[model samples]
Target: MGDYDDDTAFLGQTGPYFWTTFFLLNTVFVSTGFNGFYIVFIGASPEHRCLIPEVNLTAAWREAIIPVMSADGRQALSQCRRYKLDVIRNLSEQGLAPGRDVNLTGLEQEGCLDGWSYSKDIYQANIVTEWDLVCDDQWKVPFASSTLFVGYLLGSLISGQLSDRFGRKKIVFISLAAQCVSTIWQSFSQSWRMFCITFLFVGASQISLYISAFVLGTEMFTKTLRVVFTTLGAFLFYCIGYMMLPWIAYGIREWRTLLAVLSATTVVYIPLWWFIPESPRWLITQGRMAEAEAIVRDAARRNGVETPLVIFRRPELQTLHPGKTYTMLDVLRSKNLRCITLMCLVLWMAINVGYFGLSLNTSNLSGNPFMNCFLSAIIEVPAYVMSTWLLKKCARRTLLSTFLVIGGGVLLLIQFIPAHLEYVALALEMAGKFGFTMAFSIVYIYTAEIYPTVLRNVGMGMCSSAARIGSITAPYVIYLGTYDKVLPYILMGSLTIASSVVNFFLPETLNRDLPETLDQMQECQGLCSGPKKKKCVENGGSGHPAKQHEAKSDTA
Candidate 1:
């Protein structure tokens, strides 16, 4: 009923908080639409002609799940051993007939007409050629999966900087529409080369929407709901994907078809491109004071503040706060920042390693790939709801560390559980999922909170880049487990524990101000880096609170 003052007619501009929330929720969900579909696609994307029955040929989708070196001696699946198919195919012109040869690798139509067999590699690839990879050792499955992350890692690095330089709203439209259109092309890809190119573009474009949304939210909202709302945006992203992809996967078994359906949701997000606001903070940072003032006044008028246009010049930069600005070097110049950066990098690594590592091994989670995926995913809904609640009541640092420790503890404990406790291990994995999920959700907010505004995006982006490094490594981590399935968890649990231990030394940030200047950061009490005050005889943190806490403490 109130008069809206957005002259540009931005969609989410000057609306009730719910509409803004709805806007952000849709933004985050669409940004991640490609995730689960990519997972299912990677497994089937290399299948023979994207054939349904040909899904049985790839290491990822093949029915006879066995380790690289070991298979049951008497089992008919002696033909199912990994990497055995390529050895026979080089036999060339001396082709073995289906009726006469023992296919150590499967003959196409194994359960079908018996005499119709050919070289298992050619046969697997021949009938079904569209989406599945024939893993007769002719291709590397882990590397295939790893390539996508390679693309994701590369894409995330520059997407943020690109999004910031361009308008957030403009880039969002470009990335979303481009990715949706690219995905449609993916369904028609005839070769792995084409699939990789399309996936790379999808990964690059999709990654742009997220941090832009986060930055936009931070700038628009009041401090009251900032953390909760920002974190909630991230939480819904995974929760929705977790809830939707598996059900959709079961309904649409063909990976290409499923991707088409998944991409269709993003088409809804296309129209949203015209509506979201240009981040006011970005405008302020770019010295567009006139525009920044306009947006702020528009929101204030809507909120009934009727505030005046104000300009805050840098008095400190002119003389008062000498040596206050930070560069990337400042991140490592102090022992405190160095350790903080390293520890955070490790924590990011462990979470990525564990999350994607376990996730990539979807085949081993259970026999019914679809159901197992569904349960693993659906669990995130309740877990995310609980995380949101805990973030509100609990100290952010404590909650983060506790989740990491618990998630890691469960992973370590799972290794020793007896076979009768398969359910227990699965439960542990889900527990770790919750733990890791909580950790992942908080870290984005946490990282954003901890870094000074000047370095905030770059710092988070670099840290996220490190996280992507772990993402790249994750496929191999889980892939190696195909050689010995338990090894992946052992390594992941160790990494997670190491990450938790690292968190112990990190500066506790509860009820703290976000730092505005180096002096403010250096003077901040009990900062995670090093206890400057504590170093004065009895080591203890003592400094001014970060800028984020300044308004709060004064009121308190």
Candidate 2:
């Protein structure tokens, strides 16, 4: 592989132009985060019960007409039951006092016959309020969330190839437009089915926008800038967006209004289409050398740096063979790649399940939902910082394994806390979230480091698609908690720990020069032979022989 950086050093690696592009990409990422998690709040189930109109009784008596019943054997207000309306109506009409005059428990109870009434204390409106998706239809709410992840799965499978075939810049705008249009449609949806179907588009567009921006940033920037952009710039801004969602939901109150407001934010990105440039690498792959050079020249001019008239033609930068193309089969054909890909898929799925499960389960926590959601998002800042430092110091396999076990173990422990000690349970759940946060942050970088460049996108797409399975299943996992509070935690914890055990089999990728070909990847098998063999290769053996000629980083 040719080192394009050597020929393009004149462009200035970390310049004002780089920062400008970085921030623009970060802005798009921020919106992606907003669209991705907003469903948590928009689909929230607020305090509700069967609608009992005060047609003939005093307000206090009217409220008392609904019989108190336990759900899942846990004491709570019954959401699906009400005193037989005819019985209650007759009693009120006869001027008979309820509770005292009649045996409310002996009275025949029935589902919300007329309709269900909702409490406005927590939320003025949500999907639960608008569509009556409670009790019998309660499962629909999480399935509604699952619908978005289904879109994510589809997007993950197709977006990478689409961006590779089409330009990243083109797909981004198209996905953004699709997302905005579908979200508007969602706001206007009269039925739960319509809302769910439109959210599929929202999910697809959200992932497409995120992947396109990520690929473009990876190809356009130098090493330091790419690392910073991938970590602090894009990711940190995403956390900011995630943290903003609860506040937005708190202020908007109505689900439709919130959807409309969030949809409107997409329009803000349209102008950036004119400013963000296409990936020069992709342009070169398409044999559009002149166009690629023009972009580089413009970048140099913006940064006030001088560049040669023809930097791309240099011997070190001239191998424009369009790079090796890979498909899913290419990954499967190799024994080493197959194991690595499968392990990564399992790990990603577990991490996502734990991450989204904890995220969506916030409403069920004992505190204010907004505060819980905010804390969930806020905790990631430190997690990310810790992950960055650990990545340099710890072996990838060891760090990933340890975090998964910690996260999973904590989740399992949370299941044991008594109901009265809700705050303590909340603390343990947060601790679990913090652990999964670290694991989630490391997995992306680990996957990138594991795959060779040719198969990187396919590998990442496959793993992320697997992750969508976890996400698609996550809402249902939360639903399981209603049956038994410990079920979801047990499932998530078990999966995490099981995947952690599998982590030991995978080779540690820390500090290794990324494998560039199938042959180079074969050398990765030696990772199992122990650090002595790896150290011998790093010192100048068959492994990463190419690194000897490359400039060693001072940071490395």
Candidate 3:
């Protein structure tokens, strides 16, 4: 029945041991961002048109032979179709003026028979150019993006259980290796199917590494630094990796070369396996008392703190859980746990869908795609910093609701902006991105805090699995831009607003001790003792509201 916090108090919460582990943990965090959004560059569609065969035709003849089609409500030359080749050749041979003499508009148009030509302006190569994933095959692009998230969904389910069953440090290295290998292999893919298969592995490694790092950090740090670690430590570095992608893509225009470089760079992290240590909390949970004690003693030595052997000799601390096993059932069977899990699942899905939807939509913004992505990633830095600050000062529920509403409202407003004011639309969209990024950062920490240590990884993983569902749908949401530019924003905005309202029903987690067991969590009875729980105290039973109030004050 003893808490690990008591033992942690002796190790000194902040010290050389902690900082060293934090540094190593963040190395993996940085890599996660690199591959996380590479899909942006790899799947980007460059300007393209049907290839014109060289048949000694004059430029005017070539122009008249290509059919015109409407794209985004504007007339443009068709990318997938052209005039019949024999007709064009005959017209060229006859020297007939196409539209004036021959009435070229009446000629039969056909799909690209000679393949397509891509503009090498922004990207020289990507999956789209390589596979000709345009026109009739356009659906494959979104499906490819969705494949990566499919891997994320699968990985999220298993990583937590594996890490908990094995060790966080081991799973971290394993996933990093998988990600690196899969990324390199993906670059060499000869076909779209091969790329998608490799991407599945890449996606799996991405979420697994993230959860491993997140759970490891959670178990290692005390409550105060935990907020910083989740928001600024893990997430800020992820943004840095994201910001680097456009530059990487800019320098290495070829997808294979770009992927090779990114994958090879991760070799630098292989040595980290030897340096980082397993979590002592996890060690203790497994009844490995001697091993946990040794790590704690070493940490004490590094931190210049002295600890008597008697501290570890306490029977309760030594055998806190001799053979306790927690499963997903523990989370589902209880009323409070079930409510919180369901709410968190919804919150995670909304945050992820909106966040990824806005993030991947950078190409559709008014500015250059590279600069747009760069700025999008840059904006997250301040958003995460503010989120970290707010996590300490604001109630979790309050921040979640407020940020979601602001983000959703901004997205909703973007639809009404005049088309001529593209810059204004972009600015509003960026503001919405900022709001969602803040919410994104908060939700990770919030969800982690809501679950007990035993179920923390599983809980976060399940929530992350829900997030993958949002992510899988995100590309389709962005794909909706092909039909109606503003539709994605409207859909994401409405979902965000609905989720924000649902967030109000969630319990605030600020300044509370994390429950270590399902029973301890059930006892707390769902946000019944927080600063905002005054109404609950008045009612004295499970805090069923007498009246649903819109806003409530919270004291720190």
TM-score of each: 0.76, 0.90, 0.92
Candidate 1 lDDT over 255-374, as tens digits, reads 567667777877666456545667655554455657766665665555554454343343432322222333457677766556666767887878888877766666566445656666
* Candidate 3 clashes between residue pairs 3 or more apart in a chain or in different chains: none
Which model, 2 or 3, shows the larger lDDT? Answer: 3
Residue-level lDDT for 463 in candidate 1: 76
Each prediction's number of clashing residue pairs: 32, 1, 0
Q: List candidate 1 stretches off by more than 4 Å.
A: 1-22, 33-37, 41-76, 81-135, 309-337, 517-519, 522-556
Candidate 2 lands at a TM-score of: 0.90
lDDT of all the models against the reference? 0.57, 0.78, 0.82
Alpha carbon lDDT of residue 145, candidate 3?
93
Q: Whose TM-score is higher: candidate 1's or candidate 3's?
A: 3
